[model samples]
Target: MKKTQWFDFQNFFYKPSLTSSIKPRPFTAYSFVPFSPLAMLDPTILTIGGIVLGIAIIERILERWGVIDLVDQFSKIMRFILPVTFYGALFYFFATFML
Candidate 1:
């Protein structure tokens, strides 16, 4: 046979210490940390990295086809357009759907 113990009122008021994963850590101002590929695991950063690689591949293909000037022009056009498009979509989503 098992006996049931009564819960203490003091225990009800107590809070357990949070684990590191449960609580967010504070970042230091101007703290320098060595770059690690694991730290760059954000989806947005990965997407941008993929887009840059794709652009490089396309540029190489254009050069291979004897369209060297087109490659440069395409690179210049993409360098300016990609960031604007990325940020514009980001803000549009934040404003329209998120808000």
Candidate 2:
């Protein structure tokens, strides 16, 4: 009787070559080292946070100036602009990375 191992060590590190039928997954390039602290930071999240903070500051300033109508108008414009910009970014990411 032959004994079998539970883990298949043979195929553990198997990576398909370029000439093989199996296609490899796309890897996004990062400028910084993954192990370092900087790897924890994502620029996209930071950019969005900064934009929100800026809007908050502007809203406060407008409120102090008694320009509530202008703030309301700006928000209405942002309602349409934000979604279009977000979807455009989503499409760009899928087109650039997934395909």
* Local accuracy of candidate 1 as per-residue lDDT tens digits, 1-99: 899888777875685646555667897777365444454465665677687779878988999999989998998998897888678656654454421
> Alpha carbon lDDT of residue 26, candidate 1?
94
TM-score of each: 0.41, 0.41
Q: Over all chains combined, what TM-score does candidate 2 have?
A: 0.41
How accurate locally, in lDDT, is each candidate? 0.72, 0.68
Model 1 clash pairs are none
Per-residue accuracy of model 2 over 1-99 as CA lDDT, tens digit each: 899767466765575455878779999987664354543255664576577668767877997899999888878877876777667655654454421
After superposition, candidate 1 runs with Cα above 4 Å error: 1-37, 78-99
